[model samples]
Target: MKIVIIGAGAMGSLFGGRLAQAGEEVWLLDVWEEHVAAIRAHGLTLVDTAAETSIRLNATTQADAVGQADLVIIFVKAYATQAAARTAAGLLGPATTVLTLQNGLGNAETLAKVLGAERVAVGTTAMGATLLGPGRIKCGGHGPTHIGSFSGGATPRLHDIATIFTRAGIPTVVDNNANALVWGKLIINVGINAITALTGIPNGQVMANAETRELVRLAVAEAEAVARASGISLPAADYFDQVAAVAQATRDNRSSMLQDVTHRRRTEIDAINGAIVAAGQRLGIPTPVNETLTLLVKTLEKTYLV
Candidate 1:
């Protein structure tokens, strides 16, 4: 399979490196010149519990250089989905499957608008990764990746992508309920991300403390309520408990939002908690906790340069 990774960030590097190692023709297309240059000079360095391995692959900033990919997996930030979709034009062949494993909501929709709904698919991945530097990433854990068509039901391409991803050591499942998969991940991020970003705490401390745990519960409850109102089929009924379990499982790790705030990079608050708040307003549901979290995170972002 010929694959093009759109963002080439931490998660993107992990999936692309593994797929390339599995003998797929993979190309990483990112605007980060240094990262692209490093991968072109030396191979992409992947670090895991087993060992650090340098995986050789194609990488370029110019999408025209890697024309017509079989699969284009979007790993860009949620806010940058529109831009990424526009940039994806060079890589879209007639049969190209554009899968968004991105965070939060509306990403797949944004892609659908530009690339056509029939070609776009929605999904989520449980694998975690962190960018160490140019051409280097630490994959914290491996987990199942779920994929499905945007309009619902299983497609042959979904199964084909799942097979390729699973064969490359990234276990993937073809789930027909795309809404459930996306909302399931969004609910987790809603609980952990903003709390960790504001408190400068790891996942363990977020749930371990009585006070912060309450905050997480309230925020998650708000998101769950909004999901219910929106008719999104959530994967589990007990979202707070699910979020707590995820935090406990990855106790020591810092959330992606925390990393963003720590580094003064823009966080994905608008897509995560903010998305819930927006939906709440649209559905006439009060999401005070999530709205407050969204406002607080936005305020934090405003102060990044101050």
Candidate 2:
């Protein structure tokens, strides 16, 4: 099946490269001109802990270059989701499946508004990646990716896509509760990512510091309350363990928020912490910790933007 991956950054490149290497028809689309040029001239480069590898794949800057595809994976930053979805409109066909594996909440809803719920799938991935250079990415951690229709139904095409990814060594699962899984992932991100950004530490360091660990727990608890109020059942106890496991697995790797801070780019603070706060407001739940963290990150953003 034809697949187009929007956002071609670390996670996008990692998945696109592997899928292309596995002989699937994959196109990597991004707005970064230089990265696209470099990939077009040479090939996408992947540097993992194991070894450095390269794969020849079609890469382009214009979204229209992707044409039509059987599947479209949106991997952009959460803030960029709406724009990406609009740009990807040119690539959607009658039977195309649009899947969003972005961080935080509300992405599927956004896509559903633009692309229709019947064609929308939402998911989460534990896969970790870092952009090393223009066309270079470091794949550092491995984890399962789950995809499912937002309306909680089965899609045979999704299963076919999962099988293709599985063949590329990325474990894939199809679940009916993908929205709950997304919330679970949001809980993990709200707890770990912002703390890492504020402290300029890796995930493990945040877990190692007693003060930070307590702060994370408080943030997670607040988010859990918000989730429950929204009628979402998160893997609460399992989510805590998953957070710890991710911290241990990516001990030396800085989080995406930390990377955003270092590069002076905008963090997904709104989508992460801000999402919790918004949900709380709607449900009359107090999310003080998440609100506090959201303000802190916005404060940091002002410093960088100024």
Candidate 3:
């Protein structure tokens, strides 16, 4: 398949590199000129447990240069979803499938508004990667990726997309309840992200201490209540336990939120914890923890020069 990866950040590079390595026609598209230029010059350098290898692929900042694509996987930041989708219209063909494997909530909805709901899908991934530098990324963790139609149930395209992703070595599954999957991801991020971002600690570090663990649990509890009110049945009943397991699995790795803070970049707090707060208000569920965390993270962002 000819795929255009919009955003081309850490996760984008990893997925595009793996798919390209699997022999798909993959293009990495991003506004980061240094990253795109480096990929053009040296290929995309991927580091994993076994070895570090550079995977050759196409890349460009100008979407018009690529024309139409079979699939457009968006991995852009939550704030830039609309703008990025608007800028990449040249890459969308009539049959082009736009999949959002992005963090936070409402991303698929944003895509649906721009690309038409019929051509868009929602996805959540547990695969983790870190951008070491231009054209270089370290994929340190592997986990399942779930995808489904924006129309709310799994369809044939979900399986087809899952097949392509799995064939590229990204273990994937088709979720009939894509919104629930997204909520599950939001709960996980709500439980872990802001705490890690504020403390400058690895994911597992939160589980090591009672105080930190309690904070994570409370945050998660608030989100779980909101999820239930929204009528989304999460895959796991013990949501806090699931978050802990995820933190344990990716123990040493820093979260995307933490990385954003370290780089003084904006975070998806408004979409993660902030989303929960909005839902809580709309549904009459008080989400004090999520509300506070959202405020705190936004305050921290204010301190940054960027």
- Candidate 2 residue lDDT tens string, 1-306: 788999888889999998998999999999899999999988999987778887899999877667898999999999999998897788988899999989888899999998888889998887888788899988867888888888897788889988998998778988878878899889989889999999998777878988998898889889888888898877556556678887877777778888889889988999999999998998899999999999999999999797
TM-score of 1: 0.96
Give residue 177's error in model 1 in angstroms.
Answer: 0.8
Model-by-model lDDT, in order? 0.90, 0.87, 0.89
Q: Which ten residues in a row have the lowest lDDT in candidate 2?
A: 233-242
After superposition, the stretches of candidate 3 with alpha carbons farther than 4 Å from their true spots are: none
Give the per-residue lDDT digits (tens) of candidate 1, residues 1-306.
999999998889999999999999999999999999999999999987779999999999998798898999999999999999998876788899899999999999999999999999999887777788999988764567899999889998899999999999999999989988999999999999999999999877888899999999999988888898888878898999988877876676778888789889998999999999889989999999999999999999999756
TM-score of each: 0.96, 0.96, 0.97
Model 1 residue 61 lDDT?
Answer: 94
The predictions' CA RMSDs to the true structure, in order, are 1.4, 1.3, 1.2
